[model samples]
Target: MYYFFLDDKMLPVPPPKMEVKVNNKNKTVNLINEGEINIIKSPGLTEVSFEVMMPNEFYPFALYDNGVSNFITRLSGQQPTITYAKNYIDGFEKLKTGNNPFRLIIARFNQKFEYLSDTNMLVTLEEYNVGESSEYGFDWQVPMRFKQYRPYATKELEITTNENGEQVARVKQTRPTTKEVPKAYKVAANMTLWEACRRASGGSLDWKAVAELNGIRDNNVLKGTVLNLK
Candidate 1:
């Protein structure tokens, strides 16, 4: 048996096919007095793509982890209608909107369901395809792409006293002490600073404080702007 999970949430039905692409960052060049040689560089992000099945009807082969949520439409105090397809779609939407990296785990097992090995990594959901298909009947097929996530530091200027007792400032980079958010956030188009902070912190961060720290008078920031969270 095998299990697939994104951010600890198990997929309802295992995809019929799963493909993982380990990207290459190597460069080929001609060196001085040498023929064409490969400039072997570090590996690129590992990409995983697969089409997950969402069963509209319950089948013995289908697995359900906890319950599905109706995230898109909900009146004031009403709960969402639980459906397998909607649950998976809700998870995907959260991943795309959260702007965070989560752990993806693929576990292997024997017929008895004993643990074997696991393919585990930190990944960010890149994109996903959603539409109705005749082949799916009343069910749904969602194709998703996830890329390995590597963290980076946020650059900031630090003031320090030199040996001559003179105050000096220097640029430094460091990760965020708080675990809830990233070291820095890259602003996307039509992205508000408030929304970014809210998503990054999982509602744990105060947007006003974050904006004050970044000296952002405008909540509507430009695209590609790196917001320092330190």
Candidate 2:
């Protein structure tokens, strides 16, 4: 069994008695002989679709009333309503202001009707359809589609000063630190000091530093000459 809770008040409606489908959109890449690789992309939104039955008691007059009053009231006012249709319509309108998305709680049950996993989803309504009456009552099937709304997580960095008055990077989280190691490179024909330093230092060290360290007064050096890079 699954349950969906709309806005803050938990609304008085019971959980839908239908299957809820969840879809996750992800990016994938295919490499020959390597199968498909899932790329680390942004926290993509999710799409959910389900059917809901709204009883007559829970239905608001605004949904069935045929007039421009409902539209004007919902569009130019902040008043709250108990009607499910008005709540959803108002909630969607509020999404344009960049406010917090609506909350959807999904509760699952096992064969014994025991509690299973309870997942909380923050989403915005994307689409909805009102089905035709198949039974003889006010109850109607409302198909709803929602999209997940979540911002991407970003890495935070901390900058601090060391005892020697030198600035150092102090990460708040555990991360891999890259250490530059000294290397040796042989000068090749038609290669300048800048080019040699760039190749030996991985394009990080300056050419002046390399020339000074090697005691090379002339920028031009003979081929086959080896220089120490630190």
Candidate 3:
């Protein structure tokens, strides 16, 4: 079984297919005396697209918040179709007006109801097309597109007087000061005191001696902190 969710709310019907593609942000550069070469960069925004059908009538296979009972759907003072459609509409409104990107999750399961792997990402809705189908008569065909969202801040340039008394423009970094990794074994999320010593001394130095050399009392450490190998 397959299920799609927007912001953790499951969609009533899964789209027949969803397309995911990555935008290429690499650059082609020509070096001196060297032919053209590709400079690989971080990936660009990802795109997700699919077409879904919103039935006007409740089909037996339709799922309403994991409940397929038509009786339960009618008790909510709306048709099963309206129930599902309104949910999607609400999601669209949030995507259009919300300040932050919402989570998109796709879950799959085996026929025996065993849990399978899932994919989750933060995305911003790019576009959606709502069309009425004459053949389906009152059913809605919605084509939706979403793009991966990543937040960033732009640096501003400042006009400053140089040592020679000449005015020059300098880019001032506005983000919080970040520690520079001067060596190979800078403490990080994945690098601990023990791990750093192993790499710094290559298993030749003991942990206690390395910790004492770096003045790391009681093994207290934090990310971006440096451990001295000598």
Candidate 4:
């Protein structure tokens, strides 16, 4: 069985002999651990925890951060756009099908900021008229400061297998589904902003108008389902 754990210092540790089930058939597999494996559990941890699980051998992976919905509330002016990435086995294109196992990891992060202002000009008065004086002028400056906060998440994934092992090198993916806003059948979730924009422009959804209506800058969604882009 493959056991993962962390030390008191919160460093990830992957133990040998992890238990894995292939096509619903249980078995123990050995890890060809590349660099390091660290896992740890802290006391009284309610909100977050670190984890590392190897779904298969000989696969290099990366993480993807799905933007949070409430992230827009933290900033004053606008919401940030969400970025996506594809996780593929290192040099996957060169490998032959059925000779490689497609292993990947996904994660999410948020932007952090620090407020800095050197001038109180925002609160100071600007003389629209040279002869007229005012106590204050309408001025505000909100610059986006950014950092990354890797948050904790748990993902429930369905594993697909090849009974004949004929297409082992091919990437397995899920079927697409349409997304709607709270059962209203408005916004589609599973697509990128670009895709969503195109679909919403068709009149069934007002893709361009929603931003002005909500006073929201970005289109990052927090819905539980992924939107299927048609």
Query: How do the predictions measure up, each by TM-score?
Result: 0.62, 0.43, 0.58, 0.17
lDDT of each: 0.71, 0.55, 0.66, 0.26
Residue pair clashes in candidate 1: none
Q: Which should have the higher lDDT, number 2 or number 3?
A: 3
lDDT of 4 at 198: 33
Candidate that would win on TM-score: 1
lDDT of 3 at 216: 69
Candidate 3 local lDDT, 1-230, one digit each (tens): 77676763556678999999999999999999998999999999999999887666667666655323345445544455335575677677787678778877776667764447666787888888778768768668888998998867777899999999999999887655533433446664222354355445433455667777777664334446667765
Candidate 4: 10-residue stretch with minimal lDDT: 119-128
Order of the predicted models by lDDT, top scorer first:
1, 3, 2, 4
- Give the lDDT of residue 50 in candidate 4: 25
Q: Which ten residues in a row have the lowest lDDT in candidate 3?
A: 189-198
Please name the candidate that would achieve the greatest lDDT relative to the true structure.
Answer: 1
Clashes of 4: 20
Per-residue accuracy of model 2 over 31-138 as CA lDDT, tens digit each: 999999997654545677677655444233232211112333355442323344455445445653445666665645566544476556778777666655758265
lDDT of 1 by residue, 47-142 (tens): 999988887776656655532222211222333333468777888899989998997877666765444766878899999988688987989888
Task: Give candidate 3 misplaced runs (Cα > 4 Å).
Answer: 66-87, 151-230
Ranking by TM-score: 1, 3, 2, 4
Tell me the lDDT of model 3 at 177.
Answer: 53
